[model samples]
Target chain A: MKLYLGVAKDIVVKRTIDRRDQKRVLGNLYDYDVVIKYEIENFKDQPVILDLAESMRALRSEIGVNNQRDVEWELVADSTLTDKLDEKKSTADQAVFHVSLPLRGKDDKAVKQTHTIHLRIKNEW
Target chain B: MKLNGILTLTLALLATMPTAAKNVDLSTIPPRDTVQLTIYNSEDLTLVRETRTVTFKKGVNPLQFSWANTLIDPSSVDLRFKTHAGELELLDTTFPHDKPQMLYWAVRSEMDGDAELEVTYFTSGISWSADYVCISDPAEELMSFDGFVRITNNSGEDYADAQVRMVVGTINLVEKVRELAQRGLVSRDEAKDYERSRRKAGAFKADAKNELLSKLRADFAMAENAARQPKKIVKEGLSEYFIFSVEGTETMKNGWSKRMRLFQGHNVPFRIQYRYRPQEYGEQLVRMFLLRNDTVSRLGSTPLPDGVVRLYRDNGRDGLSFSIEQQIKYVPIGQEIELNLGRDPEVIHEWVSIRSWRNAFWFRRHGASVYYAPGKGHRIKINDAVVGWDEHQAWVERIRNYRDKPIDLQIRRSFDGHVVFRSNLEPSLNDYRSPQLTAQVEAGEKKELRYELVFHQGHNQKQTNVTLESVN
Candidate 1:
């Protein structure tokens, strides 16, 4: 049994509407990290962030395993890998499309089931 | 002398040969050293001054042209030609108004074919135009751009002490706009620009500085009067949009009372750029205003310097957006640049006002008619005898599902002349902005009874005794 995945397709980070940068609230929700390269087996079980997925359930950050451990990852529900009905958004010449998960795997017969497939992708502007 | 006087002089020489071919150059006032480009001896023109445009084709042109010593004092000048490949190299006996002059050429070409061209110079009057005016309200985060640039120097050439800067981009980003449209320097070809960016004394620096309009003005005036206008601010780019306001999503800034006329420009020489999406706590305040007055005189070609204008911010609803690329600095040559820019102090309120009520029925501005008429039928009767309104703030609510709702009412009838009635008023009042609907009309003088209108008509016949509460 073997599997793996890697990604870093298109990356855009241009801004001009700021609300006091560094922010993070809990219950009322307000957490913004823009884009950084942390890793936790590439977002545990990927596919979250559908325009923030109805106010969010879970999608923590701070990853760095092989480069020497720096964990603090969290992902609640993995979404089989996006395209839950295709449709991209374009606003006044700017662009956006996001997704990312660095690896994948699936196996059955070790007495039954063993699956762990991850993913990652991003298209921003 | 007799063939009908030669057919009336051949129809007057065929209408004077098309009025002399449409009055070729008509009055002829352009000539200060007219006829400038003469590249006969010095072949291969590489770069001719006067800004640009002097390219030769054909294998080995190598030209160096100049006439009457070449301005500044070339014994005035005079030269002309329609087509010349004979390459004379130079010619201009003498002709000069002498104040404004520009004659240059540093020829160098490895020619290929049509290596011939001629130009007659003389400028005492040359002014062209396109001007400019872009006014979009998108509900006013504010953008009412304006334009106009006119400079006619007659070619006698008198540029005293010059300093002009007007290049907003496009056409490859503004190239001195074809030398201000060739000395005539007129603007308005819909903000002309195919690609142009010139810097001699240089005036363009933006790595990401800051300044759209520090202070610059030639003449500015807003609000033609829709009750004084100026309230149309509905923005939605809060990073995702929602700058200036967002409580439930700020929205007002509508039509400023609908007087709609603004966006004006005259004589020409203007610059107006506006953008708003502030109300930021972190960072997002883009502001710029320079309505010109020119400050010290020469008036409007280009002069407004004060400095500081940097724009670029993005938040695209958290994934984080940032791309600030706006620049405008040093604008005080003549003077006029207003600034209120973005605002992110949390903003108490950005703007909001939405009241809906347009044409209420029951008309009569000059009453006394029986059923509205000068012609007789179309049924009309508005005595307005029982006008009401004094003490009643009503609201008949109840409608989560009354089963039907599609009402239409444009009532006015004494007989059947203009009456419209569609059923389904069923929505009693689901939170009607706080109950405020009163109706009561009693002519006996209780006075404040409000209003009431009752009319009946039927063409159904047979047992026609229908009064189901007057059809709701």
Candidate 2:
């Protein structure tokens, strides 16, 4: 039996905010907050264990178009839902991440930049 | 001594007869009257339907069906009454606890008589594949094509006098039939629950079952009708499935294979061309024989299945010379089939880089600053660092055809990274990254193709794709 999570329809990029003004700000580092909402469901008869950390590793974020700027992002340790799902049950959860865009120049503007986030679900046996 | 011999004979007869134990009367299954096999090549699955006459007593009659050493999925086993549907009822089917590969069905009969029962199940290890042979005449303009299908049976059971059909499309299977066949047997309650869930989810469609049975019946009728004629394959299209039903019955023994002719086309006309796709066929020119799977080519009766095609040429001296053997995918009606005969030594293709130079230099005032931005003009500074430039490259391609006949040739070249392609051959963009050139060379002629490319480097590069420009 396989679990169908409907990843395409269940995942949404909630919001992206420029968090450079937050406390503990660094001079050379640009920070942004990206929130995502997702739902995982087990529609089969067998129970499946979903490794949240492993799944979070597959999340990708890119800033700008054509010539893209390098950005690093990771799950914020907290705000992770359960790692396992029971049969015939669904869980709606939110994941928050901090994207660090390195400042290439003083005039570099990272705000309101066209960005894309891709999420893929990988099965772990 | 006569009385002793009679007693021994009676004992032997009693031992051979079916015995009733614990109110369950065990009866051996009778020989099949007619059997049909529908084999799907994409998957190791065959749907088998066979009929047999079984004598059932009034009340509950236990019939034993065993699939010992056979790759028959026990979960897919089904029993239906073909002759006395209204008079017989299947109470329940039970897999014996001690027996690993055996099952019993408790059938209730309204009246005691002989009734024909149909047993249908899915099995693995029986498969069919298709191949073709093409023989070209001395002129190479016309050819004869013949298709054949080879069916191999390794299912641990022999199917005698069975009609065979091959499906040319893929079907979705959640689980492999081989795995299920080796899964032993699940508990009756669990099996029922699984079946109920599957039905509720509509995973098992009733229409599909009906279609299968209808196709089998039609094939059986066609087989009977074509009994007197020479062996032929009748083609039918059922939704997305294309079936080739082999006429007449075949006795397929275990671990045996049989090849049957599918179709033959005589004097099918075709054309030949030479292609040079550097990205696909490496750096060599390949000869191709082209034909369409339509009536003009004498083959449009049905879609051609995927197969290996062997090409031979008639040497005009009462002998045939082998040319090439290529594998082709399934071709629908009216679709062209292109057979690649590999590199031809008679045609020589040479690609040479004539010259390369760098020009259009741009200088930057400050280090790591923009040197040449698009839509911006820059002046040369005395001590400025060189930060960008454009590189020019020229290439010459030559093709020499030594054949007696004129040859048609096509060449494709791919480039990347802000490239401007200028060629006198009037090349066109096959895609954003590749330029294509076509030419017709006369007999014993050599053609030269010249093209120049300019690649933008550093800040001069604005795009990452090739730009095609024609030059006289």
Candidate 3:
């Protein structure tokens, strides 16, 4: 484990669940049994920012992933109210701050990593 | 050297691997100006479409300004579509939020003059969603539970849409408090117990005041929001009205709307109108309480209890008597609670007659007039309000004190608290033993003032309600 501070690469998914609405309660709450889906990168060492809640897909098992070049993701948002997030793109508007995998002693230090952050608010009207 | 070569070869293979493809179809779908579609389970899959043109009544005429309630730009659809016998118009899914894709054509038949409108585009996932939110009974007066639904359209895919799901709730401000409470950050000793209990683990404070404060914060947060905005139940089928059936758990958010979160708070029932936004167009709620047992009291005195928002009033023996005659309950949830607007039967109010002589004089001086002096430099106050004004007349002979002085005053009062006095002059007697005149007021809350004036002429007296109500 090394204190590698490139972007401190973070993704904040802010979500606000307003239960005060009748339509929201019946349509959105009734479905999914209220279990929010999250992929979390659950790396035990990695944390995901809560921004685009719709992107989180709970892990059924584990998918084959390339260690060197892959996107790191997380679902970090409180379940009920709106989740606040630090601005994602530090470099630009689409700037998503994220840490890269092979985050360790990969001899391929010259290899660059690319990641995309999506924002989605799937709520009742 | 061989190991390095192997690593390079592996990297090249991974980069060249094929990616999954998303299908797109746009037949029989809603006409929309711009469409944005994204699925959580699968990615690299997105659809954006917009309406381009609309045909008119006849003559192959085309109309502009066509938009869809849900359809996105079709010409820009990314997924490929195959009709029963043919492929659809190829769409480039590039623009994310803008760009028109397809056109809605309303064409009249050249052979029969009949008309047909057609929308051509491509979209995947033959499914869409409809959401419903509900509230059973607000009149019942319980913190309500709202419900929501997510309708998944299976235009013709497979696998039951993996059990379509939708979550409903709000963001609450309780997070900070909760976090602080959990961290044992509350300063007050009482806050400790509350903090401890709320947390699953015991590393919290075990105090009541702190707990009460925390509870108050959560409760008030809910109430303030409830009062300002309608509780929103966001999901499918939100625009139209429907009977929302509560099929699962209920929750709420007590944080800043943008920061609200959900937690199990109340249970929901099926069939209620989900309020997406609270109604903000109403006056401050006025609650009324009536005095049931205590029927009549003094005249023009404390007739009803405090906060008794009376829409109507009737003349009583002493003054005015108000009561709830209609079905208007401010808070009607549990048991039948009764409150009276009339004076409490046990509350005693007393008023003295400064000049109403015993039999003969009292009868004769009825409605008699008084002349207050201008030298008084005072204004008569009824409920602390200045109503009438006069600069000259002092006394109507020994019977009345004329409107003379203008009293400049400021008053602060509560709803149940009222001060009714003549706005002009109070009869000033040089005699030291003037039989100290006074009136007693009791029992009534809520949060206000009344104005009146009195004229005394030895044993013949008359009182006129003057103005000038002031509040501070």
DockQ of each: 0.01, 0.01, 0.00
Candidate 1 lDDT, B1-472, residue by residue in tens: 1111110100011211121222222221121221111111111110111211233443222222222111221111112222343553332111112211222222323443332243322211222122333332322233333433332222222322212111221111212212322332112231121111111212322111112111111100111121122443211211111111111111111111111111233332333232222222222322333355452322333332222323222233333222222233333335564443343232111111111111112222235433222222333233322121111111111111111222111111121212222123321121211111222212221111112212221221123121111124
Give lDDT tens digits, candidate 3, residues B7-40.
Answer: 0100011111121111112222222322222211
The CA-based lDDT of model 2 is what? Answer: 0.66
Clashing pairs in 2: none
Q: On a 0 to 100 scale, what is the lDDT of residue A64 in model 1?
A: 17
Model 3, residue B366: distance off in Å is 36
Candidate 2 runs further than 4 Å off: A1-125, B1-28, B187-231, B372-377
Error of 1 at B357 (Å): 4.9
Higher-TM-score candidate of 1 and 3: 1
Native-contact fraction for each model? Answer: 0.00, 0.00, 0.00
